[model samples]
Target chain A: MSITPFNIPIVPKLKKETIYSLARKGSRIDKRKLDQFREIKITLGAAGKAHGSALVELGHTKVLAGVKIEPGRPFSDMPDQGVLNVSAEFLPIASSEFEPGPPDENAIEVARVVDRALRESQAIDLGKLAIIPGEKVWVVWVDINVLDHDGNLFDASMLAAMAALLDAKIPQHEILEDGSVRIIGPPIEPLPVKKRVVSVTIGALGNVFLVDPSLEEEAVLDTRIMFSFDEEGNLVGMQKTGAGWLDWDKVAIAFNIARNKYTVPLRALQGAFKS
Target chain B: MSGKKPPFPLLKDGKRHDGRGPMDLRPIQMKVGILHNADGSAWVKMGRTEVIAAAYGPREPPMKAMILPDRAVIRFRYHMAPFSTDERKSPAPSRREIELSKVIREALEATILTHLFPRTVIDVFAEVIQADGGTRTAAITAASLALADAGIPMKGLIAGVAVGKVEGQLVLDIDQVEDEYGEADMPVAAIVGLRKIVLLQLNGVLKPDEFLKALSMAWEGLKRIYELERSVLGSKYKGV
Candidate 1:
């Protein structure tokens, strides 16, 4: 990719004194505190012409998510649950490494992480999605498009996905035994959502962790961890990505930081949908 | 090709299916610079179909095997969004899309002044956000508009129009249903200079007379589209 050639070179092992000196001061490069999140901006209905869409900018990283609802049969095994299908596409221009084809591992991993966050948290009320109990139901297709790859795409994609779902509304329907469908116009009530789930990803670099790492940080970082929490602040899913090993102690610290950071966005998401 | 009759009628009430005259085109609307970071970009909406084309780079030539010394390499990507169709598509490029990209690349390459940027590459990405009939024509028109928006030197804008045979009548700008069930579909790409045909693709069946009639109908339509393209470019350059 063209961007990597322009990235800051990897540093050799740092001198012990410099590491200790930075560790003592409890500050990191880019002047960020350990747990403080970068600025967040959410633009709703970006593709206003789309059924439901949102663009999330977590600092420099950008993700666009769109939701489309259609009627289809639920999986036979999961007849009672609504289907949530998630897919992610990393635009070739988004980064130098992204190629044009079926999504690579990173894209797949991001999609899986977002799917887990949503499903494990029961963010959507599935029972309400059942139209014919065993015959048909509404399947929500949520697609995350990574237009810019700075870092922490998992969190940004999840954030955009959640916003898109909230913005989505399925029209009421009445199914006929002949296997045909009829649109019942607008719903008289709200679409059922069991919970509002949100996710945040944190990256660890050189023993110093940052929330919402920039593209540069993503390149330099050793490992990234993502956390999904519901409105009640209960941890729904946790995923560890990237390479290199991390001490369990640092993972614990990340968990603590995520707990504190999770509620802030949850409140914002709730307010975003109400309006 | 499926041998199944198309659901829409060709002509109704002495008018076309969409209620336009045989020579009239669907509504055409376009906007320039929809992609923020692109060097040049445009969005074209023809009837129900919407296409967005983004142009990037005059960057160094790709290091891979292919390179042309006299002309800059033009790489074209034509893709349809998953939700563009009534059915959900797996996020993978299908064979049809690859074929479309190849044809569009050749069509644009015929007129673009690639010699202006030697040892470099120019990328044109065309994404169909919605699909009706005439998607390829809309893509070509939007791509040319985007190239103009990028300020890239060109001989002149390229305008694309499709003429189809429906119920023994020649029709201009065939919609999706028409293209499917219509007896003959002939899509042509014409440039402003000599009004020459740079791109031509035809499918289904048509007699020689029908082909000639459709081509003439498209040529006439091209004259009107040329005026619109000229005015679009004129308005933009007027500000400069």
Candidate 2:
């Protein structure tokens, strides 16, 4: 982590007001429709040194995911399972608003959301990662580096993380006679991916629902709900961010939109691994 | 130091290990204004060393104490990602990073007309995502491009390059292998138009005459890098 300065500037009130009015008319400042997402591009194995890596672009927002697997002790509560550690860095170079420092609240929130969605949904088969049950288990560390942030980093980062996991391969190892393990060869065996999880974020401004809000729209957003769904459309994880509240009807609309929008990201993720 | 020689011969048949003449630089690719949220951003790839730099603000200083009534302050940060190296580095800014940040700030501050924006701060964030060697110079070069892209007033762009001695032969653009085993390393940053050296750091040892030789070699490398910088900036605003 780098050093961060003390003061952070805020978005202008006039801009927020303009964004609010534009949303009311079913248009966005970026000219995006109410339920439209920006263009998405995914590149697999962007970080050649990492075991698995993916670079994702949601319009102007860019996120890189790198996965590193190492042998480590399993948690006491989960001896038969491997560990999945996900961390997100809101790199200072990404945006003017982001500062250089340790993971801030927003960074922590993004990491937790991505982590919960993948872990709770059982995207990776942890049992296959277990080498010695209680003693040694493979730990997968997913490091999400935000290169550029336009808006909607949550979805972009989640998509990259999931794709990186899919692209990951477990390194070949040998169980030694003394019960210790030795990494013998290059990375082999594609990670056991059980399901694909896609996270969709919906921003609310008054009575309007905006999909994939831009930075300006996010500034004026009253509330935001992130829904994480699996391929089967199961609600694996859900989190409500911001200070505003959402009634049941608005939540229902968000859910429906998330279900419908899951395919967009799913197609993008599949296309990345296909080549 | 123990009299341990380098594992491999750094020079053979008047060519360096990578099979280049004494003054040949590695391939360089640069892109400007790549980040959407940043006011100005640039990405540079010199061989395997990849760095991205972003510039924000001639805005109010973040801290009151940092405010300068006479001129704007340049807040520069140089960071290497945890996974940037062969071994994972801790995310914390080390003493080397802090010192590099100061040196990089001084290098760019020489060219920037800070007096034009008093009581303001120009933040330059440089991150080395992949490092083979000479990351400091690479970062500074990218940062200068980012500042220019940000529309910051400057006398001219600054170009950075390093000259090193390997196997008793002067070489341009030291890579990771040469950097570790080389006899001497000299990193220099200069104002491209002014021909003034703003940053100069010498490691290992060099004779006074050899120092002059290294400086000249660095100057030539700087000229090539400056051309690339100009071309990258030109491509950004072709009509203008």
Candidate 3:
């Protein structure tokens, strides 16, 4: 869980404040191209102690994701498959309304979006994580901490997680005599990573669609569509959140815009892993 | 700060298990004006624990709670994050948190000039993102800073410090491990005014002599923190 329910800074009613003038002028307050995203900045290995970590700033929205790998007994049901556990923490420093407690619906939805994108895309080669074929495997624990909440946290978290996972490396393990795993040494080889996944969030505002809504934009958005696009521009998963419905034509338009805008950041992720 | 007796008597080596000396305080980092929307806010980092406080409204008080004719109501809510520690915490505040809230409220009420705004409610919300040790103290300190930042009138800035006994020696600012495994943990909220003591809460065992000595240690460290708070506020409100 990331944020508390009582202090959720987002006020849906605040959206009403913008209806009159913006609709009259057919423009946004920030005056950005309708399809343009907020400014983005990504940094890798920010938490030096963690196995892998990255800090992502999508405009004013900031998220830090740290990946920790630990060797432990595999789940009895699926001993062979590795595990990926995602957790989120929404800090109050980001916004005044963030109360402290278990992750609220917003945080849960963010984690679920990132988790589903990772799983459905098969971004991690789980088969290579198996040590003894069916006994031991590497479990990747990704903790995403939301340091600031200016908006578009979902996209920022996904980017941070992906960047951190790419920066992570698992050590070689040997099955012990007591059916336990013994730490041998650093992995002589790197874990196999099949594909890279990233997500882009677009919001619909009064017949106009915008990408990566800012904190102010997020308050007024009626519908938000998060598109998970791979490096090849293939859509892996698309989730429509909130109450508003999107016409089929608008959905198609948003997909194309996401695919096009995604490559710019996707290339940045590749370069981040390279360095 | 290190190089003293151990903080926990039950633990071995006269060494606090968390690797701090008896008189040592945890690493603390504080930043003011973190929240854009709040009138004033602060982020306090005590060891690995992160606590944020925001002050909102001297707005019209909630009608039901406005029975008081002279003084404004100070409403406070203290909450810990679910993933702040190893164990998962429930969403709602527990008995301990509720009690801590009362202690904190009492402490702040004494220092803040609530009578200045009779018909308003000042909201002080403290959210603990991470809980290592001495969270209540940190929250108190942060809340005072937030209130000051919000430009609310007050007698003086209040700073909270804790002094606990370990291995029969007094330690300042107990960490999570020491607080959990030590002999006694005492947390105090001190004001810069002539009345130094505003709130004090102690748990576990301690002799009267030990209690007095621990109280003195807390006051000494608290004086230093109060100066820090003043300097920070001065710099923030310079020329204004």
Candidate 4:
């Protein structure tokens, strides 16, 4: 048995009304189009000791992702392949509504959503990471820490994680005479990343869809849907959260918007990695 | 996406491993009011998967903070018994259970009339005694019955189902083997009369068009299951 996380972000009635009415007119409080996104800024190799790290800012929301790879036992189900574990923690400093505690449903949901996208897309060549068939393998961990809370944590956190993984350097290892593997060199080889997966999150203000919503807009959303796509526009993962419902028409429109609009952020991420 | 084939064939000529067609569901059997002491109870068996669900409360909430001012807090938990599967899962809650519990709660909450019982708590528990596949959706279907049997006023009933791709052919109500070996699996729940999807989740890869087609297929399955729920509850409450 577990307790539910408290309802978040007590929003003002006037703010909700203002956001909703403007949305119905195909406008946003931030003066962006229904499908337009805010500017994204990324910084990599910032964490001192982590194998890899990246900090991404989507508008005012800030998330930092750090990658750590270690030797660990393989899961029984996939003994021949390595494991990818993703975890997200919302620091109390990130928002007044957040507190110091174990991850609640919000944290768990976002983490799982990101994990599914990466694993399902086979973004990394996990099968090549096994050191021993059933006993040991390289475990890649992507830990996303929200440093600031604005809105659309899913998109920002995902970008930070993607950048971090691309920047990661796998630790060099050697097999000893007794059959034990040892990390004998500094992290050098680039992680075996194969694909670039981007995610889009659309928030509904009634029937209107707003992409990459700000914090104020999130407080007023009836519900939000998140979708992940690979470079080729293949759908890899999807999750619809919030206690509200989406009609089939709204979903179709959102899907169309997601399929076309993912490249905006995908280009942003790719450009950041290049620079 | 169709390059690697499954070790064992999951489909042959549009027929599944168990002889179900592309759009056919597994044989479903259900019973309500099985637990006399519970305010509401139900047992559901769809193929090899079995589940029992119970609802209690609209009683005083445990903590003052949890009591809502404008709506009752509807709490739903989906748990699997230790013997539910072949591998004997531990009693402790796994990450999958924690996430599923929340997903199921949100799905069912869409239809419940929580405003009618403000400052109280309505609790529903769905325990999977046997699981092959599509446990969350089945749990939601059963829990909705339990809530209705408890006399909780809901706007509508929820019907849950899963659709998957086997051998590049779309199929309905996937079994455990197909779920494990299939290239794609998506679980969906919807309010049939309202024509609204309450819960939707997906894993594996699909083209956008394939995804859309799969959703439509899942909706059709939900409509059929929704009718079964209406008849069962009608028989219990209205003696129809």
Candidates' C-alpha lDDT: 0.72, 0.81, 0.72, 0.86
Q: For candidate 4, what is the lDDT?
A: 0.86
TM-score of chain A of each: 0.86, 0.93, 0.86, 0.95
Whichever of 1 and 2 has more TM-score, that candidate is 2
lDDT of 4 by residue, A100-166 (tens): 9988777888888899889889998898888888888889999999999999999998889888999
Candidate 2 CAPRI classification by DockQ: incorrect
DockQ of each: 0.01, 0.01, 0.01, 0.60
Model 3 Cα lDDT, one tens digit per residue, A1-275: 11111222445465545742473465567776666777668898799877788998887788999987776556665667677778777877777767688765556656766876776566887766776656667888889999998888878988998988887877666777887887687544544668888877888765667777777876676557777766766555555554333443354566667777887568778777676
Please state how well chain A of candidate 2 matches the true chain A, as a TM-score. 0.93
Tens-digit lDDT track of model 2 for B1-240: 011366788899988888878999989999998999888999999999999999998988767887776678777889999999998999987646765775677667667888899888888999999989889999989999999999998888988888888877889999888887776667777777776556655554455456557767888899999999998899889957
- Quick one: ranking by lDDT, best first? 4, 2, 1, 3
Calculate model 3's interface RMSD in Å: 24.5
Best by lDDT: 4
Task: State how far residue A30 of model 2 sits from its true place (Å).
Answer: 1.7
**Better-scoring candidate (TM-score), 2 or 4:** 4
Question: What fraction of the real A-B contacts shows up in model 4?
Answer: 0.58
